[model samples]
Target chain A: MTLTPKGEARREALLDAVLRVLERDGASGVTHRSVAAEAGVPVASATYYFATLDDLFVSALRRATQQQVALFADLGEHDLRGFAEVMHDWAFTHRGAAIAQYELMFLAMRRDALRADAEAWYGALEHAIDPERLHPVRTRVTAHAIDGLLLRMLWLGEPSTVGEIEAAVREITSAISA
Target chain B: MTLTPKGEARREALLDAVLRVLERDGASGVTHRSVAAEAGVPVASATYYFATLDDLFVSALRRATQQQVALFADLGEHDLRGFAEVMHDWAFTHRGAAIAQYELMFLAMRRDALRADAEAWYGALEHAIDPERLHPVRTRVTAHAIDGLLLRMLWLGEPSTVGEIEAAVREITSAISA
Candidate 1:
């Protein structure tokens, strides 16, 4: 059923709550009650909006991925240094969201329904890198390399300096160019 | 306290059980009771072996990282292609352990005590890649890139082909050599 504007806003709020919970407590902390508590809504509201806990997670994941894709879509406008700075800031400042994204990725490994979203997220990264500048395989490889670096930074709880990230971006770009 | 031979064996068994539970269930599934059950030991045994759940997780993560470092330390013996093949196979066959490692990494992000282990894990990887051949920064960058690539493969639940991994490894090696 189509939600009224108010209902739509509430739904969005609930989804945001799911992400907050995921980031704060990881996947296991995300239950119907926990999400509802995080959202400041009644537990019934979560069940009403998303029939299953999986549905809530999937919906939140889709929204988060879309926002990220949109953010990356604009990266081409920035030079390598500028792009690296943006990435460095984005990851460190948005640590919670970044960690939550990885949590969803692990969840995708076990749940078939979440696989497409994960692929699309990676596809967005590949596209943002502007694969046209490189060989097809190199483009894919570069994207994966960047992915791994960000993940490592997150996992280690160590944010790379802008200079370090710039050097990495330049290295990958140069490799693809070569 | 130094343990007798049997006590050491029991401790090892408990740690293995932690990994098993971590692999089968995500980090959240790991609890005192669950680990004890996995070890086929009494609940008291788990509590006796590790004073707290956090202690158990920390000990298990250390063991896992050491084992990984040992595995990577031998990579020099293999040619690039051989190394790539092994990586491809490892990611696919040990998918559970791979994911569990990532899960632990996220846990490390939250828990202060676990951060050093995570840092050392990356340090071992950087050492394995051998920075002497590359500029110190380049070596660090290269290590992070490979990490990103491996993590992407695991996150997407798509095993890279041997050719794909080999190409990526060669590119990184060549870039460092240059």
Candidate 2:
């Protein structure tokens, strides 16, 4: 569907609002009313953007994927050195994204459309990481390893010491060491 | 609640049913009525066995914990080595369970009581793998890394190869080997 510039901007705002809703309140927060409220538009405007719940879900998921990809993209054209700092940021802020993503994952398991969105998200993630420089074997190994670490920290949120943080950095560096 | 042998056996059957429900239908499947249907018992039997939803959640989680522990108990109690085969089993047969556990983790995020239950589950997991072996730096690092690997595999399904699997196994073995 073609959109006027204003409509495009509003759509971006709506997608951002949906991400915030999903990030904050999770799956329960994604109703049409809530999206309208979050995006500063009337409830009717939500329909203008997303024709159905499936459309809304797919749009929100696309926004989440783009946001996550930008997160890694912001790390710039650097080597895998960017991983540790990104993880540290996740330990601080993007914490809830892990849960939202996990829940989406289970949802994806049973739904082919959602699974396609998820796979697209993962593909974007894989692309942003630039896996060629590191050994493909080690790159994939450490990729899952780092993903797991981020997930566990998000789940438990155990208090971390300076030393513990440094050690986690060292361990990741060593695992996929260039 | 006190129980005759028949009642005790029925309760045991009910808990087994809760686990089966979780494995099949995930967290939403644990309601008193749904679980009763799965167990082939009267709905009243659920209220008889589990007084409250919280009690039911804890019992179901604890039962999951026990089965997992018992499954590993046969590994003869080493560090990372003991879990290798079990991890492989999960990497295959119970991929769905792994996905569900991660989804259950998201559900826990919304509830403090359930989060506490999650902490308890992690406590059992941590107990199985000796912290001392992870050394001063690697303790939490190792835990998080393993978690990331498992979830990534569950998400990707069969995309990973034996070489990549061995790379993960090698990293864990090397960590505790330290």
Candidate 3:
């Protein structure tokens, strides 16, 4: 996937703006025109960057999932304190995308055009945890728990504060630590 | 609310079809025509019975909410047996309604007209938990967890089994058991 420098820069800016639109108004607020306005570019730029709504959505979801996977990967060896804080802070760092991602998931599940996207998104999620050698059952439940916590927190749009993050993580760890 | 026999019967039939449509098609599939068709009534009857689209959505949501509340209420006194069963038995039941409920929730959050509807739903959920008397700090977290668990298990679709439910409840009980 090679592109001109200008094209690469434009694509990055467009992706960032899509994230912004997703943040402020959720998935409903995102559109070709809106993303263009958000990126300070012509509407055609979005079409140039991505072929269809599904293309854009799937790419964005992949990017978000990669970020999430990287975030988890970098946290060495689960000290509880460090890992928990980061996990707790996630709802704060990317609240809009979290909400939009979940909303898109609903679309994926309900419509034929998007089920593959949803499946791929979930596959990325399970892959992020790497099921090898873990208690398959407990690991599956734990992943669901983690996914549920993030999505639910997004659904609630709970404002994050330092105190709130600490408290939330502590409560979460309390359940999962066993 | 008292009504003529025809009105009462129509209302009950409408609500039943509402749940059916929601379970089969997620939030987007709901429409007066669909409900009327599903219930074997004419679309004109739906229009006559429901003054507006918003009214219909609210009524359907209310019925769905009430049904869920009743289900939980029947569990009585916070014992986790049936809750566990529902969470675990996703294979047989399919998590259609769970996913549909979340979709409707997202839809409500996206628009002002619906947000009010959504808030009432959340308020009922809050009341359902009875966040008084034991561990106030943990109550909200517990509520969020429960919300997350339901959606997550729904997304997981079927791999989550009855034993998983039993184990999860045991874990939860251990954490919160004073």
Complex DockQ, candidate 3: 0.24
lDDT of 1 by residue, A1-178 (tens): 9899998999999999998898788777899999999999999999999999879878988898888877777676437776786678767887878888877777667777777787787787877776464556566666766776787667664547888778778876675455
TM-score, B chain alone, candidates in order: 0.87, 0.75, 0.78
Q: What is the lDDT of residue B113 in candidate 3?
A: 52
Ranking by TM-score: 1, 2, 3
lDDT string for model 2 (A1-178, tens) is: 8999999999888888877787788865688889889999999898888877657767767667666667776666534446556666666566667566556566566565565665665555555555444545445545555665566566566434334554565566474453
What TM value does the first chain of each candidate achieve?
0.88, 0.79, 0.73
Candidate ranking (DockQ, best to worst)? 1, 2, 3
Please report the candidate that would top TM-score against the real structure.
1
> Number of backbone collisions per candidate, in order?
1, 1, 0
Residue clash pairs of candidate 1: A148-B148
Alpha-carbon TM-score of each model against the true structure: 0.88, 0.74, 0.66
- Which model, 1 or 3, shows the larger lDDT? 1
Please tell me which predicted candidate would have the highest lDDT against the true structure. 1
Which 10-residue window in model 3 chain B sums to the lowest lDDT? Answer: B124-133
Candidates in descending lDDT order: 1, 2, 3
lDDT of 3 at A115: 47
What value does DockQ give for candidate 2?
0.37
Q: Taking chain A of candidate 1, what TM-score results? A: 0.88
Candidate 2 chain A: minimum summed lDDT over ten consecutive residues — where?
A: A158-167
Where does candidate 2 stray beyond 4 Å?
A1-14, A36-54, A76-85, A112-132, A159-166, A175-178, B1-15, B28-32, B42-58, B77-85, B110-143, B159-168, B171-178
